[model samples]
Target: MTIQRLEVSNPEFTPNNTQMVTVHSSHLKRRHDINFYNVNASGQNLPVIILLHGVYGNSWVWMNLGGIDKAYEKVKAELNIPEFILAMPSDGGRLDGSAYLPSLNAGNYEKWIVEDVIDACKQTLDSVTHNSHFYISGLSMGGYGALRLGAKYPNLFNGISAHSAITKLADMAHFVETPLSEYQCEHSSEADVMYWLKKNHHQLPKIRFDCGQDDVLYESNLQFEKQLKDAQIPYLFEQFSGGHEWAYWHLHVQKTVKFFADIEQSL
Candidate 1:
């Protein structure tokens, strides 16, 4: 999709500090809209947070779910979080999602997240840049991407959080046609979260992930946590009473933002 400048007249939002913009992605061969928010745009020494969406969803999920306003209102007024910019991007993948992977066969979705998304943020907002403190979080599929990316590029982020994330590569078999082994091996170091984290242990970022007790991915999350514990990789995991729905993600996203805030304090 070609992205062009336009006015946002959608009555669905109240418009606090949010905006809709487009950034071109060479990897995806298209320009896509990004749901962006700059909390105190003129405020100095602010950090940046990137939120990824799950399957069958787009960046608007954050807004539609009301996490955006809550994060802005709470992070500033209530929580001790520092000033930060939040960006939500549509992963430009057809069907369900890209799983934030790059493949010659499946197109370059990883670059869309790691490269295009970052570049767009810096260019679109004056307060963000390569040197700004960075963090990532997502729901379900987005959660998988956030954790994978945190390990893949620890230097780019201070921390990473995931909710109801898919920890194994094979769990995505039903969404795409490619084999899990082949997909993970394409254009990246490793696909499996545990495998990638172990291989890049030295570059891992501050990590934490939690899943709903009744979610289908609960067992997968447990297995992933076990792997991390067995390997002695320090992280935080929590189980709350909910399912794999927006109600669960929306409530827990507040915790994720607070988690990032904690990491900021440590640094």
Candidate 2:
């Protein structure tokens, strides 16, 4: 893993005010090196939250959005919290273009986040250890990525929240009557997303799903909520006045941080 200092700014943070570090995933055998953002406290050790972004974005989206501090300013202040870090890794996929599924080009993003990226962060960052837990969340494509990661790596993440995410790729394929483009090659089969759910279903983490009423993905998200309900999964769900845009996501990001902070204290 490689680390470098980055100049970042937003409504809530500036370069000096927040420690912005770039993370490079070094899987020696792999062809590509993934990039991600690490927003951390100035000193001491604290629990970390692995903040996954959507398909079309890199790790810098969180810092670009408002910095982690701005999103969770009120909650952190009100709770008198200990230091925490946000791990944002570029999932090595197209930005705002591809869905974060295992594609022919991007390889298996699930493994990249669950193993490779986490491993790199643990090695590169002193505060991050193998046992350090994470609270994960995302918006749109990111939301889908978060859900997939949390469900797949229950032991790694304590909880997860999604804002306007694509909950089910299989459902979307069925909805559109088309297989995922990347999974459409002659010998390639569609990703068994449901199989992933069933196999790891027993290890599911605390889940949360929310979306804008006017978002195009609203119906898809609603179907996912039903699957959770039918499966007796415990989660928090909310609907707000907006669409699948940055405005809603910016506010929703705060809610995610609060959720993480709350869960960390309980542990």
* Clashing pairs counted in every model: 0, 3
What count of clashes does model 1 give?
Answer: 0
Stretches off by above 4 angstroms in model 1 are 1-14, 173-189
Q: Give the TM-score of candidate 1.
A: 0.88
Candidate 1 per-residue lDDT over residues 77-186, each given as its tens digit: 88666777888888675557778877656567777887777777666566776678878888888888998888888778889999989777677753456555555444
Clashing pairs in 2: 54-142, 56-95, 56-96
**Model 2 RMSD in angstroms:** 5.0
Give the RMSD in angstroms, all C-alphas superposed, for model 1.
3.6
Q: In angstroms, give how far residue 167 of model 1 lies from its true place.
A: 0.9
**How far does residue 147 in candidate 2 sit from its true spot (Å)?**
0.9
By lDDT, who's the top model here?
A: 1
